[model samples]
Target: MRRIPLFVLGVAAVAAAAVLIAPGDDEYPANVVLPSATGLIPGSKVLVNGFDAGQVDEVSIKDGRAQVTMRLTNDFAPLHAGASARIVWKAVLGERQLDVRDGPETNPVIPAGGTLDGKASDPVEMDKVLAALDPATRTHLSSLVQGLDHTVVGNETDLRQTLRQAGPAMEALGGVLRAVGSDGPAIRELVGQLNSMVTTLVNRDQQVRAIVSGLSGATEAVVQQRDQLRAALAKLPGTLGTADRMLADVPGTVDKAVPLLEDLRPATDRLPAVARTLRPVLADLRPTVAQLRPTLGALGTLLQFTPGLLDSAHGALPGTESAVTSLTPALSFLRPYTPEVVGWLSNWGSSAANYDSNGHYMRVNIPAGISSFDNNPGVMPPGMVSDPFPAPGAIAGQPWTDAFGSGVR
Candidate 1:
């Protein structure tokens, strides 16, 4: 008032305007994550309940996430949990804004500088929509719609009746659709498997045809032998009954035979090696067997004669025993004189050996004994000169004299 400087007053007015325009500390900064930050920047409006609530103070990328810092007014303080924020636009190319649909008031308030997790909604681009539909598809769609419209108009009554009848069918179809939808992956796999099987069958068509041809031939053969087959079939029941009885006893048979089988196991295991070893032996034995053939025939002949020989020997055996028994007494009587008789015979044989074909006879000579030859000739020598010698009593002269008496009278 007292001559104030005009420049200073001007600077003071600018300072008051800055202070009035700047945001106060009462505002809360909420961090929101968006899928994308396209067409968004700082100073973008944040709306709550279709009203402007705050502005985005910062927009940045941290750790690959698009982060938007929204500074909300004090009236909208403390966003609760489950509150969501979306980036929306008026039109495809319009300016983007944040729209927060918060949770109930009963939820706990979010403090200042808190975070609110959110998603970004993408606006439909007219150019992309236009690109998706080509001229031909658009033409077909128009024709299809026209046809459907005309059909619906003409079949109103029939359509109503069809819809009435199809109500339960539709309900059932809904359930089937739900089942298919729930197991869509499994159903798709099943369809793929069926398709593969069909393709394999198609590839093996020639084999399938051959199998069919074989089946037809078998059928014809069966038909030709139908009567025989029928008779066999008629007898089959009795055969089957017998077999069934045998089968029923098989358990007991097997139980009894188990020990035998176990015992035979070792032998059976050794059989293959034994058979291999026997092969060479049997080959070598073939020639021996051939040579034995004639020997076998001779043996058979000898065997026939053997019985007769044995019978004759058997009959003679008793007499032979009796003969041996009868010689026992005579043998015993001569047993004592055997040595003396043997000695005497040996000495006499030695003495008689002097007589030989050379006219040499053994002479008995005792130097001191009387000589039988005398030089005087007697009228009759008391010895017979005939072929027969006289007896000792009949002889007249003493032909021989003993020490006690004359020899002959």
Candidate 2:
């Protein structure tokens, strides 16, 4: 009876040891906080990189967040510091799972029962996507679907033909994709350059907007002048034809000019010498040219009044012409007497030239006539009358005489 009791006690100890060392003990517990626990529940499957590696042991809401406790198997236990988890759809029937991803190897491994620093991503639900759309968008989406349905309804044969033709096109597109994939580094560089360009454009967005506005205005102007442009275009063909005809004569013109060009060769050869000779002359003219600047400015100022001066001259021209016409006849009539006037002026100057100390005086002589009071009858000459007061017939019959015997009849 004592041996049986000892054996039973040993067996109990071994069973306890086995239970302590079981595979379940290798599992590590961890906690992850999520924004919501909508699809998660206790006993939900946990996947690590798409492989089942653990299970959600409990899910509780605390501080407005879903605190999920997970028991991971040994293979995925002690996840690194950067490890993350997300609740994802597992099936079409609203089934959900926790998807855990391993962190980079550079990160420190997380201890068992520790909370993961990374938060769980919220589950993406189709119903939520549908609910997010506004009424107009939903209506448009429905219309698009109906349109597609209508388009496909009666186009089976055409669709088949299109599909058949698309095979080669798809193959070509695949080849192009493969080519692009092979040149990924170059494509990446191009993409980087494009990104840099886009960034520069974004930095100068105001200038870009101004340019776009200017282009829009220019486009509008062009549109407004489209009729004029069209007319110009209509005339262009004839213009081009005329130009072509003109150009056709060019070779003959060139041929004809060849001899002239050859004839000018000697002169052309001398041009360098002429240029060299003129170099110093041009240099000498520089100061003169500089001096002329003020003069030229004055000339320009004077030139500004030229039009007004010309107008004034034009206004005076008619009066001058009329005066010249009036004076012409008088001048012509006096022309023949010019010599007599000149002689008289000369004689008068000579006559007035005689002078003495008492100044110039003219001598006068009076001879006795028939009417003189001192006249005697015995001294009377032939045909003379002695009466002081003679009859008119007697006065008429006698001729008057001066002391010089010059008779005045």
Candidate 3:
């Protein structure tokens, strides 16, 4: 009896499991027929408008019309009536789903046994995008694809040859990568060397910074002194002005100095001759002075004797008083002669040459002919010479005259 009970329990559990694994029963929503959904796949998420509302259970064809059964969510019963259904792929190669869109609010719910007369989407049926293409474009596309297929089929040998040729290189690359992966010490040693190099550079960083800073300061100083540097530069304006003035004065100074220097040059050139001549003369003059030195010493020594000599001479000078009376007549005779001498001097030379009228130059002397421009008149043209020629606003010695009829104040 217990075996019978156990058998009954086993049969009941099997029946329950069978019901649990079964496909959709007749209790589910009735399948709707969509003539446009022939190529749609099963298990695709069905959308109402843009929202997920159900999944497609099956796709069927009958009497040249497609039928897709949509098992809708509980909240999407509004899609039961008056909704348009279309089929679309999930992704490029993904499953295809049926989507329903609600018409205007007044559109009645789709009847239970009603047919959904709708169009397939672009990818599956391509009714919309296909309509835009010309019939010739379709024929060309078909021919192009056929040509491509033929060409690819024809190049199978070449493709296999190329792939076969690439095999060795790929294997070599793989081997090299595998070798690199196995090189532990080389990689670690390289890393250590890199680290050591970095440390060395870091140790010298302060010196590099100091050099950089010094260079920066030098650059700044140079920038600040730019104008002074430019002034000191050998540019045309400042440089040539100095050159021009120097050159301009060189001729005149050379002219003035050349003759003097030339005259001195001869004296300099004859220095040996003069020295030779003066050598003996100076030799004789030295002895003559030496000989005169005794005489001068004797004269100096005779200071005491000269007073006694002078006393004797004074004693020798007897009375001139008696002669003074005779000298009166001679003195009167000299008075007349003095007046004649004064008149003779008046007719001698120009008043300038007179000692009382001590001006050295008054006129150009014919023998002294044009002594200098200093005393010569009309050396420069009249009005052409002044202390500074062409003073302010003067043009070629013409004084700047005011707009009025008078000279500038």
Taken over the whole model, the C-alpha lDDT of each candidate is 0.79, 0.80, 0.67
Output the lDDT of residue 308, model 1. Answer: 97
RMSD per prediction, one decimal?
22.1, 22.4, 37.0
Cα lDDT tens digits, model 1, 186-262, are 99999999999999999999999999999999999999999999999999999999999999999999999999999
Q: In model 2, where is the ten-residue run with the lowest total lDDT?
A: 400-409
TM-score for each model: 0.28, 0.31, 0.24
Instruction: Give a tens-digit lDDT track for model 2, residues 218-246.
Output: 99999999999999999999999999999
Off by over 4 Å in 1: 1-162, 238-288, 292-409
Residue 205 C-alpha lDDT in model 2: 100
Clashing pairs in 2: none
> Quick one: best TM-score, which candidate?
2
lDDT of 3 by residue, 1-409 (tens): 6899999999999877544333244222436565466447677777766566767777788777777776765465533445667776655553577767666677665433345556675464355556778999988988999999988897999989999999999889867865675576799899999999999889999988999999999999999999988877747587789899999999899899988998899779989998998999898899788899889888898996999998987876665666777798777545434544565565454544644355464343455334345766656654454444223234334444442245322
- Give model 2's TM-score versus the native structure: 0.31
